[model samples]
Target: MSGIILLLQFIAAVIMLPLHILNFLGFWDAIIKKLFPLFYNKLCETYNKSMDEHKRGIFSNISDFSGPSKELRLLEVGCGTGANFKFYPSGCKVTCLDINPNFQKFLSKSQAKNDHLIYERFLLASVDNMTSVADGSMDVVVCTLLACSVPNIPAILKEIQRVLRPGGAFYFIEHVASTDESSWTGFFQKVLNPSWSLIFDRCSLRKTTWKDLENAKFSELNLRHITAPTSVKLIGPHIIGYAVK
Candidate 1:
C-alpha cells in the first residue's frame, strides 16, 4: 500500500509541474485575454450542466429574493468567459463581471436575449473596490473559483456586502485549505500554493479560506472541501462552499 501511494504521488507531481511554471509567468492570463472566445466557448461546452446545477443549488435557499424588482438582479463577479454557465429562470437577470473584459463578447453573443446583460460597459471595477456597482443593487452574487486570486479579499467581501441587497445571496465554489490538518497535506499546500499562484496567474489555494467568508458579515454561511485524484503532482485538496447574505 505504501509503495502504491508513493508511485501515485510521483506521477501526479510530474504532470502539474509544467502548469505551475506557466502560472508563475502569468502566461495564462495573457493568452486568455487576447483570445477570449476560445476560453468562453470551452466553458459553455464543458461546464454547462454541472455549473447550471451548481448555480441552481446555490440559489435554492435564496430563491425568495427572485420576485420582481426592476428585472430580478443577479451579479456574477469574476465571470470568466461565461464558462460553465447555467440558465437562471427568466425574470432573474444576470450581470457578469471579470478581470478580463475580453470575455464579454461571449455573453453578448451567446447569452439568452432576454438577459439584462450588464457587461462592464460602464467602467472597470475590481472586487476590492466596487465603485461601479451601487450599494444594495443586486439580489444575488455568484462567484466560481474566484477570490483565491483576489489581492484584498476583505475589501471584496465588504464590496459584496455593500452591493448586495439586504437578504441577498452570495454563492461560490472555491478551492480552499485542505480539510485534513495533517502534515502531509499541510506541507504540500504550502509548497503548492506559491507555484500554483504563479502558473494560474491569480490562484493560491491558501487565500481561499473559511475565515475570509466568516468575516464578511454574512448571516448564513456554508462551507465544504472538495478533493479530486491527482493526475499531476498537485492534487487532493479543494473546498466548495456557499454563503448567504
Candidate 2:
C-alpha cells in the first residue's frame, strides 16, 4: 500500500513538473493576455452596436444617471485592457480595478483613445476585496467577461453589492456553464478546464453565472442568455444583464 501511494505521488509530480515550470515562468498568462485583446477586440467591434443598444435599454430606466450637472460615478471591476471603454457615456467618471497591474499600459491607451470618459482612478485589487472603494458610492458597476475567472464569485458579488448605491446598476457580461452539461462544447469545456485554468490566471471554463447572479443580494436581476460569436467552445455561451442594488 505504501509503495503504491508513493508511486502515484511520483507519477502526479512527473505530470505536473512541466506545468509548474510554465507557471513559474508566467509564459501562458503573458502570451494569452497579450494576444487575447487582438481577437476579442475584433469581435467586440463587430458586436458592440447591439451590446450598446442593450446597455442603453438598461440605463434608460435609471432616473439619476449622468447628466449635464452630475457625472455618473462608475466602477469597472476586472477592466481588462479597457475593452468596454467606448460603450460608456461621455464625461462619466470611470474607476478601474484589476488584479494584474500589467494591463495599466493598455488601459492608459484605451483612456487616451476614448477621451469622452473621465478616467478617475485605477486600483490594483482583487474583485473579491475592493476595500479601497467606499460603500454605497458607485452609481454604476460594470464587469465584462469577469465572473468566469474570479476565485470567489459570491464574495465578488457581495463586494459589488456593498459598493453600489441604492438603485445603482450592476452591468455584467459573462460566459457561463451550459445547461446541457453532456453536450460537445460542454464536454470540451470540462476536459480543457484544468489546463485552461492553469494557463489563463485561473479562468474557469465552467461557471453558473445566471444562477450565481440570481442568488446574489441584488434587489433586481434582469439577465439574458446569448450565444457569443466567439467560436471557442469553452466560453461561447454568455449572459448579459444588469442587477439593481
Candidate 3:
C-alpha cells in the first residue's frame, strides 16, 4: 500500500512538473493567461505572508525610484499576461510589449471597464528593437520577472535607454543568479538548466545576474538581494532590486 501511494505521488509530481516549468517560463501563457487567472487571482489576492513580505520589502526598495506614476507613460517590456497591471496604480498609462502570442488573450480579457487601470496597451515585439516606440517617449520602463529570460539584454537596455525620456526611471523584478550561496539554487541550476531549456523552449536560470543590470546604461542605481528557502529558492535563486536611470 505504501509503495503504491509513493508511486502515485511520483507520477503526479512528474506530470505537474512540466506544467509548472512551462508556466514559470511563460511558454504556457498562451493558454495559461486566460485559464490560469482564476487560479492566480486567488493566489495573488490571498497572498503568502512570506512572499508578500519579501515582495513588499523588495517593491518598496524599488518604489523609491518610482517617483510618481500618476502622469507617467510606463512601458513594460515582456509583460507576461500583464500580471503586474493589477499591481500598478490606475492613473498611470501602462503599455506592455512582449513577443509571446500567449499573453494576447489576457490582454483582451483585461477590459478594465471598472478597474482603476488606465491606458493599458500591449505590443508584440522584442526589446532588442523597439522601433515602434518613439525616441524619448516613455517616462518609466518596468520589467518584472521578464528580464530573467530576456535574450538580448544589452541591446534591450540600449533600446530602453533610447526610448525612456531623460530622467525617466527603469524598474525591474528579476530572479538573479547567486553570488553568495552555492547550495540549493546553484546546485539545481547546474543540474536542471539543460532540461529546463529543453522543455521551456528558451529560458535560463543561471544566465541572468546583477552584472547584466550593472552593465546596462543606467545610473543612480541601487541593488538588493532577496533569498528564500529550498522550495522557492530552487526556482528563484536571488531576487534583484533595480532602480536606475
lDDT of each: 0.64, 0.78, 0.63
When 1 and 2 are scored with TM-score, the better candidate is 2
The model with the greatest TM-score is 2
Q: lDDT winner among the candidates?
A: 2
On residues 1-245, what C-alpha lDDT tens digit does candidate 2 reach at each position? 44654565456556767876766786767766665656545655655654566656655544354434476899999987787887777778999999877677777888899999888899999999999999988989999878888878888999999998887889988888776876877766665666667655677878887888999988888898877666465677788888988
| Model 3 TM-score on a 0 to 1 scale | 0.72
- lDDT for 245 in candidate 2 is 86
* Candidate 1 local lDDT, residue 29: 66
lDDT measured at residue 179 in model 1 versus the true structure, 0 to 100:
61
Each candidate's root-mean-square deviation in Å?
5.4, 5.5, 7.1
Candidate that beats the other on TM-score, 2 or 3, i.e. the better one: 2
Tens digits of lDDT, candidate 3, 1-245: 44654565456557668776776787775754455445433433343333555555544532333335437678888765555665555466777788766656665555354266566567879888888999988878877666656677778788888988777877766666666445655655655554454444456667655777778768766677666433455555555465556
Comparing 1 with 2 on lDDT, the higher-scoring candidate is 2
